[model samples]
Target: MANNIFEKSITDSLINRVNQLTPTTPNQWGKMNVAQMLAHCNVTYEMTYENKHPKPNAFVKFMLKLFAKSTVVGSKPYKKNGQTAPQFIVKDAKDFGVEKERLVQYLKKTQELGEKHFHNRESHSFGRLTKEEWSAMFHKHLEHHLRQFGV
Candidate 1:
């Protein structure tokens, strides 16, 4: 796995990748535009640090625990056009700039907090996570979406 995938440098890399994408950038898979992809990437962080969304029900948590957690936190890369949590589905159009800035800010905050802050932290649905698990969740999700947009 890549090192410090949640660090400021990683965030900067993501910012650079995202910046390289124009509004006209085409996707390699799925139906999202670059803006929507950015928005989709933001949802993971949103689920972590914000109270905007409710926690999944017990059954949903069971489903994620039994089925999704391994794939999400494993070393293997996600399959293209993979399934996602429902909260992550972005149906509305997004502004590339707006989502870009928001994602940057979120990344900055996460980096500033450092791995110690997130190590074994309580996740909304997955319960406690090791730093590597957290990193996997963060890095893999972004890479998956970026690949989707052909970045």
Candidate 2:
């Protein structure tokens, strides 16, 4: 079975990865600085948990469903320095500590909610997803960025 966010072990691993990051940490690749990276990472969960960003219109959502759904929910890992969604881009500087703490909280909350909680959850862009899809979207994204920073 694939490692997933619903598993406590996987969640711990992700937390550890985040913990390894510091304000001074430099990216192995990608344009965002450490603070921006952390903020960028939080955007995923924010999309899931908060309504901070507006949902894509029907046409845009359909486009994302066709073009981006597979990359996000598939088992295949993300390529380094891939293009980010407009909402995911962190344009300004962020506070590393604040972003890190928020991300950790989001991870823990998701883990506590568990796979059953995520089954058929409505995604911000790609519509409804199964627990596995949710896990893949959450885990792979964090893993990709963490790996990008050489954590």
Candidate 3:
């Protein structure tokens, strides 16, 4: 979004935008509450860090390659009501404070590690990523969800 995509200033600004949202704020698009949206955002980093979720099978991987990869790593922004990972679909509301703090911690951890640390990082599903691709995936996904919740 900004010239310095991975700079603390940009990440901090996104955090601020997330903090600006309240529980009562209506979504400009999408079904998730603000807290759920934050949790949804955290899933990307969780996928990168934690090994809790299983990797997709060959067929599923092929499908993601053909359909999901472009939307995830490409320059175009995600549409407001587009498809989401099954684990990310929180039907009920979430505790706002918990989700917010967790996401902030994830962001801080990621930034502290920086690009080179992630340049050859093994992704749970995608194998490995270049620093720039990691930056694109992180920034674009967060921007998409933040815009959805009107933050």
* Candidate closest to the true structure, highest TM-score: 2
Q: Please give the distance, in angstroms, between residue 145's alpha carbon in candidate 2 and its true position after superposition.
A: 0.6
Residues 1-151 of candidate 1: C-alpha lDDT, one tens digit per residue: 3757667778788768877887788889887888898898888988898998899888988888889899998889998877877888998999888898888787778878878999999888888899989888888888888778877
Instruction: Give the range where candidate 2 is weakest over 10 consecutive residues by summed lDDT.
Output: 1-10
lDDT of each: 0.84, 0.93, 0.78
Q: Which stretches of candidate 2 lie over 4 Å from their true place?
A: none
Q: How far is candidate 2 from the true structure (C-alpha RMSD, Å)?
A: 0.8
- Which consecutive 10 residues in model 3 have the weakest lDDT in total? 1-10
In angstroms, the error of model 2 at 11 is 0.1
**TM-score of model 2 vs. true structure:** 0.97
**Over 4 Å off in model 3, which ranges?**
1-5
Q: What tens-digit string does per-residue lDDT give for candidate 3 at 1-151?
A: 3423467887788778878887777778877878888888888888888986788887887787678776777788877688887866778778888888988888888888888788867665565667777888888988888787777
Give per-model TM-scores: 0.92, 0.97, 0.89
User: RMSD for each model, in Å, please?
Assistant: 1.5, 0.8, 1.9
Question: How many clashes show up in model 3?
Answer: 0
Model 2 residue 70 lDDT?
99
